[model samples]
Every structure is written in structure tokens, then in C-alpha cells.
Target: MNDTSLKANFLSFTGRAKILHMTWFAFFVTFLVWFSHAPLLLAIQESMGLSDQQIKTLLILNVALTIPARIITGMLVDVYGPRKTYSAMLVATAGLCFFFAAATSFEALALARFLMGFVGAGFVIGIRMISEWYPAKQLGLAEGIYKGMGNVGSAVAAITLPTLAIMFGGEDGWRYATAVTGVIALLYSIVYYKSVSDTPVGSTYFKPNKSGGLEVTSKRDFFFYLIMNIPMYGALAVLTWKVSGLGLLSELSANIVYGLLVAIYLFQARQIYNVNREIFHTPVEPVLQYNFKQVAILSLAYAVTFGSELAVVSMLPLFFKDTFLIPMSLAGIFGACFAITDVLSCPSGGFISDKFGRKTSLVILLSGAAVGFFAMSQIGSDWPISLAVVVMVISSFFLGSAAGCVFAVVPLIKRRLTGQIAGMVGAYGNIGAVLFLTVFSLVSPSAFFMTIAGGIALAAITSMFLEEPKNTLAEVMPDGTIQLIEVH
Candidate 1:
């Protein structure tokens, strides 16, 4: 089908298209609930008599759980399938939202916010679902639409929740607004569970051959997997250090958490060994082998793409307010334009990948992103505000598109292992956020932008090593028959 026909068919509410829409909406609602509190932080702080330190703690707690949760959710989706996994996550996050809304104390609210981080894992579930329904030719656009639209949830929350709070009209308006998100989450959980299936009719839903950790096809890949896992734990440690530096945890508690992280890494390494131990003694069949370099490179690329996105989105409003001498509201509007572009930019990246090639699209997008950020770093008070906004919008387009391009290659890696692969890649985005945000904390905005540009330059170079997906990827069936899925 031509691209125009495929896009027109995307509007129809039947077959694979329906699944695509349903899954993306499911992801959207989860993100809406996940970020519902961000735009209402002032209201939350005023109503609760919160100090700046306490509010910062709440922000830290919000993302602390997501890194590990994505890893776990990936494993569960691979084991239980997206239908069940997505539904359960929605239901659980609804409960957490309600808990957050009803909290009467800082401790209760912090715990609820921390637990709500798991809602972010909902993105990985839909990835596997979309991969199952769409062919390789259309997979990039489909996954892009799913991710790009779903990502709008955060922007939606930013745009709508404050207004909803005002409509409720009281000191507790934020609470009521938050409760509304919870109620919607509760209703949609049921809607999603009843409406979606793990795979299309007559198609097999591939599952991982082993559980606990991702199964690598060779000893070298096994060691590479372990090395890649280090950054995730390191990111968690950074969060712990940040929190401790803020005096949220005692030094003793911080040390204990550090020890716990080390122990967890050791345990995870053992799990990886247990899952791939056979590779130490016997070589995996050539047909089943996949390069771990693909996963590593994609992870690094996403750290630059989506990771910088999260960090930038969090700081952009402040950056504009301080640099451009704008009102908070107008600065927020400018900042929001960055995320809003995801609706178009992400799908554009994916379509470009579908029409051109994955590696080519990513390199071009990342290169543009590098240039965009470098330009942004040069902005100052003397620059026209409109020009600055244009620069930011351009930077956002390349960054969001690069993110879309990264995921376009994810589902093509290994059919049965798609969830785990998406999980690791997604987690790296968080790791990138933590890394970049840390740099922002220690440097000026210009320096921060320069650092991100440098990171993108590195990612663009690393992406040069990426091998595009071929025409077919082989998977073994229950009866030992080889099934080939079209990938190119």
C-alpha cells in the first residue's frame, strides 16, 4: 500500500488499525495519570503548606520507581502478554492516584507519587502489542503513532488539569482534579481489558523461553547484557544520591540503599546467568542469534533522545522564564510547545524510517538534533523571543523524532524478546534524564544545552554501527519449526 492509503486506513476502526488506536489510547491515559500532579504542583504545595525542599522531594520520588518498574514490566509483558499487563497496571495506578489524591500528610503523598511511577511502564506493553499487529513496513509509523499520541498525555495533563482544578474552585481543587484522573483510570482499565487481545486471530503470541532475565544467545552477548545493566543501576544510585543530598534520607539509609542496589545488581546478574547458562556450554543455533550491540546502541541513542527530552521538558519552563524574562504562564506555554510537537514529529520520524531506512533516519534526525541543541545553547536575552521559540521548537522536533526512530528499530530486534528490549531502551531514556538533569543542576543553561548537544553527537556516531533489520527474523515454534517474520 502507498503511504497515503496506509494513513487513510489508519483512520478506520477495524482490524489492526483498531488495535493500534486502542493500545495507544491505553498508553495515553496511563501517562495522563502518571504526570497529573506535575502541573498542579503549586496548588498541591499551597494546599499542603509544603516547602520547596518537600516539593523537590516529591518530584524525585515520582520517577524513582520507573527505571526498575520498566525492567520488571517488560518481563511481565513477555510472560503474561500486554492485554493482561496493561489492564493490571491501569487498575493499580488508579488506586495509587486515589491514594495520592486523598493523602493528608507528606509521607503518604510521597509514597503514592513514588508508586505511581510504575504507570510509566505502560509504554512498553503497547510496544509489544503494536509489533504483533503491524507488519514491518507499517510498524514504524504504527509504533510512532502509538508513542507520539500517548506522549501527549503529559502535555494534556499540563494543559487541562490546572483548568480542572480551577473549575473545582477551592483549596482542595487540586485533590478533586487528581481524583478525576484516578476515576478515569479506573473506568479505562476495564475498557482496555475487554477491548484488546494479545495478538491477532490465528497468529502465535511469542513468549520468552525463560523468565527472571532476558535470555541472550551467546556468552559474549551475556556479558554485554550485564555491562549494559550497570548504567540502569548507576542511574538508580544517582537518584539515591540526589535524594540523600537533599536530606530526604539519612546517611545511614543512603548507605543501606547503596548496598541494596549492589545486592540487587548481583542478584540480577545471577538471574541473567541462570537464563543464559546453556550458552556457556553450548552455542545457540545461528538462526536464533542476534547482536547485543543493537540493543546497546539503541539504549545509548534513546538516552540522548528521550532522556534529554524528559530532562528538558522538566526544565524548559524555568529556562524560558529566567532567560527570556517572561511570565511563568507564557514560559510554560513555550515549554509545552516542545512536547506538543511530539504528535507530529514522532510520527514523521517513524514514517521517514519506514520510507527510507532505520539507520539513515536515526543518523539524520540525531544530527539535526545535535545542531538544534547547539543553536539553542547560543540563545540569550538579546535574541528575539520568537526566534528562541523557533529554535526550541526545531530542537524538540528533532529530539522527539529521534526518539520515534529509536523505537522503530526496537520491535524488529527479536520477536519474543521485544518487551525486554523495549524495556531496556525505555529505561535508558530515564537514565538519560537523570544524567542530563544532574548536569543541568551543576551548570548554566547554555552549558547544559551544550552537554546535551555533545551527547547527541556521540549518539549519532554510535548509531553508525547499527545494522538495519533484514527482510526476515527467525523464531522457533513449539514443534521446532522455524517461523520467519517480515522485518524489512
Candidate 2:
């Protein structure tokens, strides 16, 4: 394609483009609030006189609610629609932000942090919204843009909120600054609700036939789906165990929390079965008969990209402080490279897929990211901190781009179930974090890099199974009229 034609396809925002932009911004605010504590944790520790164990417990609490929250939110988005669901989530998140900002003790902080995890669920909503707007062929690139741009919210918090806290000054500065983020959430909820719709004009929004469950087309897929869900709930059980059962929590609290977690996971499993129960009797026909290979490959791809990032992000500050002898404050500034690269690389990754092809773009990106991680293993003991920072940024570019590569293809598979599909794909990213961070606990930095390389290589081989978008998707309405949605 010529430059003009490529520009028209990518830069077109008159219809879904505007909504894509708006939806990503809504996702951005979710992360901003979700991670608002990171930059202020030190201050919170200082002001609250918390013990090391309490601090660690708080960190565990931050992500504990998100696993099941995303599963439920994914189902809700399909039923209530992404537009309404996203709006309601924003309002709920802003309220959690207020609770967090006003917390004056360890108990309050723990409650607030757990509540904030709900914002992380917002990621699932936009998967459906973006899928509604784009066709199969261009789905990868468009979904990539929506995901990558929205992910920059983590970078934004890393870059801006701490400084905002400093500017405000005083012991309670972090609190006021956090409240400022809450204001953004409250205002944006209004903006997003008014600015976008779930479907474009003249198009009908198709709700899923089953609520609280995923509709499967085959018996094998039904079992496969259940196996996949194990990790989602298992990850939560792990977090709860770490918080209450391990040294982080007292023995008494751990036992209680563990019991609570088991109950919750069982409840969710029941819901999952409810959603997929129809497949046991008879398979449902697909709107577009694409292989699940694309979704499976993308899930593995993100495990390395976003997954490794999460593992590395939690440790980067300490890595800088130890390796380069930087102060805690400066270490944080340097560590920000891991996140800031998303603004560019994620979009660039998607754009490349649009220009070339999905499978090719992902293979290239995963290969480069493997090298980036390997290079990261070799930061010389005598190297200046700048060199290490440069290495991280380069690695982040590939990592962020690979993230773009994954989402660029997410929406193309099943437009109607994009939220559920994206939720599953997106959850693998968190799974990577749990698995990789566990490895980080056991090995040297070099081993961590090597393990990630091995994982990415596996993901690359799986990429072979993804088929490029072609022809048109056949959407059969309940009235038995079929509409052909063009992929070109």
C-alpha cells in the first residue's frame, strides 16, 4: 500500500477511531488509579510507621481482587455492554481512590488497595468496544492501538504523580496528589459515557446468548477452557496464601483468608460452568469460523511481553539501587524506562503488523525481545547506570511492541466474544507475572532472563498456527438474517 492509503486506514478516526481513542483513555485512567500507590509507598510507609511485613502484605493485596474481578467484569461487559460497564467501573474506581487517599492506617490502606484492584478489570471492557468497531483483517492493529495506548497509564503514573506529590509538599502530600487522580477518574467517567457508544450508528449490538459463562463450540474446547481457568483462580489463591499464610500474614489470619479464597474460587467455577453449559448438549455455530490458535498464540506472546514487564517492574528500583548505587528516588526515575516505552513501542508494534502481517510481525518482535532480555542479563558490573537504562529502554521497545503485536490480532477472531477472549488472553499476562516473579525469587538475574527467552521462543513457535484474516465474517442474527462484515 502507498503512504496515503496506509495513512487513511490507520489514521481514520471519524467513526470507530474516535471511540478507540476515547476507550483507551478510559483504560488509561484505570491504571493510573490502580498504580497510584507505587510512587507513594515509601511516603506511606514513613507516615504510617508500618512494618516490612505489612508493606509486603499491602503489595499482595493490591492485585488480589483483580483475578476474579476480570472474570466477572468480562461477563458483565458482554451483557451490559462495554459502554455502560466501563462507565460504572470508572465510578466505582474513583470511589476506591477516595478511600485509598484518605486511609490513615494499615487496615485502611489494605482495604483501599484491595478495592482499587477492581479498576484493573477495566481492561476487559475495551476489548469488546474495539472489536465492535474494527473488522477481522485490521483487528490486530486497531486492538493493538487501543491496548498499547491505554497501557501507557502505568508510565504516566510513574512519570507524573510522584512529582505532583512533591509539588504539593507536606507529609500528606501523597494523599492530596492521589485525590487529584480521583478527580480525573470522576470527570472522565462523564466524558467517556457521553463520548462513545458500544456500536456504530445503524448497527445492532448483539448480546451473548449465555450470561456468566463462555459459549464453547466443541467438547474439547469446553474442557480446554476449564483447564485455562484454573490458573486465573489459582493465581489468586497463591496471592492470598502469600498474604495470610506465609510470613506476610499471621498463621490465624492466613487460615481464615485461605478458606475465604477457596469459597470464592468455587463460586467462580460454578459461574464458568453456567456460561459454558450449552456445549455439553450441542455445539453452537460460530459467527466466524477461525481457529483458536491466534488467541492462544497471543496469550503466550503477552506472557513474555507484559508478564515479564510486571515481574521486572516490581524489582527495577532495587536493581538500580544495588547495581548502580543510586538513591531510592533516582532509582525510581531510572526504572521508569520499563514502562515509558509503551507509549511508542506498543503503537509501533501494531502499526508494523498492519503494514506487514500478524504472524510475521509477532515472530520478528518475539525474536528481538528475546535478544533484548538476553542483553539485559549482561549489564556489566562496572557499567554506568545510563548504559543499563539504555538497555532497558531498548528491551522495553520490543516488549511493548510485542504487546502491541498480541492485541493487534485479538479482535479479529470473534467480534461478539472479544471481551471474553481478550480477558483470557490478557489474564495470561498476569499469569506470566506470577510465574516469572516466582522464578525471580529463586534465581539470579541472568537465570531470570534466560527463562523468559525460553518462554518467548515457545510462544514464537506457536505463532505458526495463526491464520491471517481473509474474506468476510458471517454474523447470523436471531431473526435468521446473515450480515457479511468485510475483513478488507
Candidate 3:
């Protein structure tokens, strides 16, 4: 079938497409609950008498746990399958939503937000789900549709929560509004659990060889995997530092958290060593071997694409207001235009990657994003407002599309390892958001755009080293038979 037929199939609820719709809606609900507080932060502050520092702390804490949560969720999904994993997460986070909404103290709110970070890991779960249901020929577009549509949950939250808050009509209206999201989540958990399977009937659900960490083919790749894990821990440390800098945590507490992070990293490294220890003594069969560089390069590219997109989304309103002397409300509309492009751009990127070659599509998309960001850096007060908005939309398309292209290649790496690989790459996207947000805090907006452009350009160069995936992947099935899964 052609792209048109496939896209038409996407609109209907049947077969694998039914699974795709259900899975993406699960993701959509997760994002909805995950970002529910963003639109209501002002009301939350007013109701709880939160200081600016405390509010910022809540935001930092919100994402702090997600860096590790994605990694943990990836492992769980591979072990337990997406159906159980996602349903459990939704149920758990529903309770968190109620807890956050009911919290009377800043400490309670902070704790709730920190735990809610797990919801961000919902993205990784569906990547494995869609890959399980879709063929290599349509995987990119399927994954893209899943992401592009599901991501609108945040926008939906932004649009609807405030109205709901007003409809409730009280100082604690935000609380009521927030609790409704939990209700949605709690109800959807059951719907998702009953509606989906790990894979289609009779299709094998692949699992990693070892449970502790990603399996690698060689000792060198083993070390490389360990090194890649450091940045995730580092991102958490950075959040700790940011909170401490705001005087939300005492220096002693910050030091303790830092020490704990180090200890946890050591524990995780040991687990990774345990999982891949066999590689140290024996070489993996050539047929089972897959390069670790694909994960590394995609992680970097996602850091540039999704990471910058998040950072820019957060600050764009202020940047637009200050640069163009527009009203803050109007600027917010303009800022939102950037993210709105994700709906179309993400699927388009995946389609491009599907129709063309993965490596070539990714290189061009990243390079185009770099150029788009470079164009954004040149925007100034002297430019026409309309022209600036055009530049923002065009640039955002490249960034969003690049992110879609990164994930297009993720699942084809190794069937059993897709969850872990998606987890690491997904986590890096969060790391990028954290690191780039930090840069935004420290530098001029123009400088921030330039920095991202440079990073994306470097990632594009890195993409040249990413070997295209083989036409088929070899997975050992139950009863000791090897199954050749067509990838391309």
C-alpha cells in the first residue's frame, strides 16, 4: 500500500492500527498528566503561597526523576511487556496526580512532582509496542504518528486545564482541574490494559538476554554502554545543583544527593558489568552482533533535536515578547506555533526516512535543523514580526522532524534490545532538555540558538558514522530456533 492508504488506515481502529491508536492514546494521557501542573502553576503558587524559588524547584523536580525513570521503565517494559508496564504506570501516576492536587505543603508538592517524572517514560513503552505491531516498511510512519499525535496531550492540557480550573470556581480550582486528569488516567489504565497485547497473536515478544542492562556484543561496546550511562546521572546531578543554587536544598543536602548519585551510578555500572560479563570472556556470534554506535549517535541527535525543542518551547514566549515587544499572551501563541509543528513534521520526517534511506534522511534532517537554528539565531527586534514567526515555524519543523528521524532508526537495531535502546535514546532527549535549559539560563537567547545549531551540526557529522540497518534482524525464538525478522 502507498503512504495515502496507510495514513487512511491510521484513521480507522482495526488490526495493528487499533493497537497503534490505543497505545498512542495511552501515551497521550501520560503526557497530559505529566504536564498538568504547567498550566496551573500560577494558581498553585497563589493557593499554596509558593515562592518563585519554590516554583522553580517544583519544575526542576518534575523532570529530575525522569532521566532515570526512562531507563528503569525501559527495563521493565522489556521484562514485563508494554501492556502491563504502561497500565501499571498509569495507575501509579494517577495516584500521584491526586496526591499532587491534594498537597497542602510545598514539600508534598515537590515530592509528588518528582515521582510524576515516571510518566515521561511512557514514550519509550509505545515505541516498542508500535515496532512490535508494524513492519519495517511502515515502522517509521507508525512510530511518527504515535509520537506526533500523542505529544498533543501537553498542548491539550495547556488549553483545557485553565478553563476547567475556572469552571470549578474556587481558590483550589486548580486542584479540581488537576484531579480530573488523574480520573482520566485511572480510567484509561483499564482501557489500555484490556485493549492491547504485547504483540499480535502468535508473534513472539522479544526480551533482552540479560535483565540488568543492555547486552553488548563485545567488551569495547560494554565499556561504551557504561560511559553513555554517565550523562543520565549527570543530568540528575545538574538538577540537584540547580535546586541547591536556588537555596531550595541546603549545601549539605546537595552534597549528600551528589554522593548518592555517585553511589547509584556505581551500583548500575556493576549491574551492567554483570549483564555483559560474558562478552569479556567470549566473543558474541557475528549474526547476533549489532553496533552500539547507532544508539550513541541517535542519542546525540535526539539531544539536539528534542532537547532543544523542549528548551526553546519553555523560553520562547519570553524571548518573543522581549524581542518583538509583543504582549505576553500574544507571544505565547507565537511560541506555541513552534511546538504545533510537531503534529505534521514528526510524521513527515518518518515518512521521509521510510521512503529514502535512514542514514541519508537523518543526516539531511539534522543538517537542515542546524541551518534552521542558525536562521533563528539571526532573528532580532529589527525584523518584521510576521517574518520572525515564519522563521520560528520553519525552524521548529526541522527540529521536530529531526527528532522523528532519530526514532525511525531506533527499533531496527535489535529486536530484543529495542526497549533498552529506545530508553537510553529517550533519556538522552531529557538530558539534552536539561543541559540546553541550563545553557539558556546562562547565555543570551541568540547564543542559545547558536549553541544548539552547532551541537546539531556536530550530531549530523556523527550521523555519517551510523551504519544503515541490515534488511533483517536475527532473533532466537523459543525452542531454540532463530527467526529472521525483516527490518527493511
- Cα lDDT listed for each candidate: 0.93, 0.79, 0.92
* Residue 392 lDDT, candidate 2, scale 0-100: 86
lDDT of 1 by residue, 1-488 (tens): 35653453788888889999989999999999999999999999999999898899999889988999999999999999999999999899889999999999999999999898899889999999999988888888989999999999998898899999999989999999989988988898899899989998889988999999998888888999999999999998999999998888999999999999999999999999999899989998898889999999999999999999999988999999999889999998998898899999988889899989999999999999999999999999999999999999999999999999999999999999999999999999999999999999999999999999999999999999999998889998888899998899
- Candidate 2 segments exceeding 4 Å error: 1-14, 136-138, 245-248, 252-269, 286-290, 326-330, 382-387
- Count of residue pairs whose backbone atoms collide, per candidate: 0, 4, 0
Indicate which candidate wins on lDDT.
1
Worst 10 residues of 2 by lDDT: 1-10
| Residue 406 displacement (Å), model 2 | 1.0
- Give per-residue lDDT, candidate 1, residue 292: 91
Better of 2 and 3 by lDDT: 3
Q: Candidate 1: which stretches are off by over 4 Å?
A: 1-8
Superposed by TM-score, candidate 2 places the C-alpha of residue 196 at a distance from the truth, in angstroms, of 1.2
lDDT of 1 at 42: 98
- Model 3 residue runs over 4 Å out of place are 1-8
Q: Write the residue-wise lDDT of candidate 3 on 1-488 in tens digits.
A: 35653453777799899999999899999999999999999999999999999999999989888888888898998989999999998999799999999999999999999999988999999999999998888888889999999999999999999999999989999999999999999999999999999898889998987898888898888889989999998999999999999988899999999999999999999999999888888898898899998899999999989999989999999999999888999999999899889999999888899999899999999999899899899999999999989888988888888889888999999989888899999999999999999999999999999999999999999999999989888999977788899888
Measured with C-alpha atoms, the lDDT of residue 380 in candidate 1 is 96
Measured by TM-score, how close is model 1 to the native structure? 0.98
Between prediction 1 and prediction 3, the one with superior lDDT is 1
